[model samples]
Target: MSKALTSFLGENLADLKDKGLYNIIDPVEGPNGPIIKIGGRELINLSSNNYLGLATDSRLKEVGKQAIDQYGVGAGAVRTINGTMDVHLKLEETIATFKGTEAAIAYQSGFNCNMAAISAVMDKHDAILSDELNHASIIDGCRLSKAKIIRFNHSDMEDLRKKAKEAKESGLYNKLMVITDGVFSMDGDIAKLPEIVEIAEEFDLITYVDDAHGSGVLGKGAGTVKHFGLSDKVDFQIGTLSKAIGVVGGYVAGKSDLIDWLKVRSRPFLFSTALTPADVVACTRAIELLMESTELHDRLWENGNYLKAGLKALGFDIGVSETPITPCIIGDEKLTQTFSQRLNEEGVYAKSIVFPTVPKGTGRVRNMPTAAHTKDMLDQAISIYEKVGKELGILA
Candidate 1:
């Protein structure tokens, strides 16, 4: 109702549209899976983060519904209050066990977990060396800490070492922390955690890893820290219930004292309503499944390799992805969006990602291969990519 506010939004939205930066969110007609129905059309889904396809698993669905029936749809209050249900404790315990940490604390979402955890531990007197290509939530959380944020080049160990030395030797801040994504979501590259840990140890830097994309896909489903045999060395391991867990929430798994401090001091846990009983229970079961077997994890990597090989054969630059995430790099933003749109028309559903999600002129149609995608589905998607690429002059 405020004219000035309306005018500001109108101008910005028009600017976004003109710059090809406005995102059009699509609605799925059914559950997200290997194949999803969107706007009444069935397409092989390559745009989702449902890495293990647990989002639509029958077992998870059943457990979620059971919780809804027994409890309710909502948590009803913040965690510091009546919202801390028995199921919440169980989910945190499950996270701690899965992450191989002494304790863990859950939050309303992965983004919230970053916001709460960072500010809870670091402040203006601290400095953080963050990955240049970390997720948006990590950037926001670091900003919230009011800490002096320094960005190291993406996956450049030498730069990280130099920065760590500078920050540590400066001795101007009360503490120095280094944070990075366990897996770089855009390029599907695994972080060089081994070297990062080495630098951290050398500089006495506190360590934090946002393992959202690596939770169920790395370290035999434990995570990136475990992937590098640094479970005990990592001070904070952040993860999501929404992605591979196929539920909703986020958490920080760390030392018992850190967990206790987060419970009492994290703003989101203290101010926001907790995760629902259904979400908590479903997440717990997901972790259990991950711990019990590596079937899904193996399948996910298989699918990823299959897709990547096919794309590479067809002359697509997939960047330097070391994981199941595939990006068909299209240097122009509008062309990238057009490539994705044409794929959807041809029965594949990969979305275009451009600046500021990625650097300018490096827009891409990113694909996330899940454990549940059949060979036929992947083959079909690859064929579609070829057809679209040739037609659009992207391939010879």
Candidate 2:
């Protein structure tokens, strides 16, 4: 490697480590359920995005194994080519029905879906009004589109309305669109979609919502757009099969024309290999399960509320999260890292989030309470948290 590249990497890595911002990953020894094994130690796992615990469900696993037996290990080609299998079409149809959209198209992953969908629709001649707290994929997608990106304050409806009106009245762009995450991941706050839709209608701006964290946790498992009753108004509803669905891939659900256009213009769909047969089949089955019953969904919320109440009662700064995603705010970076380390050592695996994942001073240990977590597990986790918080002087 060149000396310049070596120096750059060494300097940046050292800087991150010195500032307590570098992340250390732990490999899970078994299934990433409510309990996980790291380095042969069993811990109450609060770090996974497996909200419904379907990642280890026997039903999903059985179907996936059957699919692999039937369709081999991979799709073997891109969607526009020979990769679009019958199961792929079935998953897309399931997504469309689940999202209440006329049509939908699946992609390799959520990040790729954003990269493909955003750039395929918007261009240098257009403008995109994005929420300030949207996921990094949305940011990269907006950049890839070469559109003028105007960021509004995080969930500040007045700010969004003002920006939308200005962008619309200016007439500098041919098309205008607004995009946001249905639920902000870090803070776990629900987006102001109802007001956003009202403003979009007034300004005639296209609406896009990426409900990666909201699906299977909100809107009765349909997602944030549906939760707000803006299913008919929002132009693009993007979701991940990886998160709540307990599978791997993503999709954009919308009108038939938009799906058709994306099928032709979206580079990822045209160039990248399609999802595996097993993953596609499992994803379709997961959606079917969510549509058929809310048992898992209700349990998820119950655990979430119980955990949040326990933490808040213990004097931890549980932020204003509206969903199952919970964050215990620790203001100092090093202190936050120490808090998480203590939790891990005491048999919990909630990880720390610091800059640049979140702001510098507002570090946190983000907890994800899933449907599979029994009250006994949560109680033990809370006891461990109480002990750690007291030791760390984070609680009185």
Q: What TM-score, over all chains together, does every model reach?
A: 0.98, 0.99
- Per residue, candidate 2 scores C-alpha lDDT tens digits across 287-381 of 99999999999999999999999999999998899998999999999999999999999999999999999998999999999999999999999
Candidate 1's TM-score reads 0.98
111-189: candidate 1 lDDT, tens digit per residue: 9999999999999999999999999999999999999999999989999999989988888889999999999999989
Q: Give, for candidate 2, the lowest lDDT window spanning 10 residues.
A: 222-231
Model 2 CA deviation exceeding 4 Å by range: none
Q: What is the lDDT of residue 28 in candidate 1?
A: 96
- Please give the RMSD of candidate 2 to the true structure: 0.7
How far does residue 395 in candidate 1 sit from its true spot (Å)? Answer: 0.4
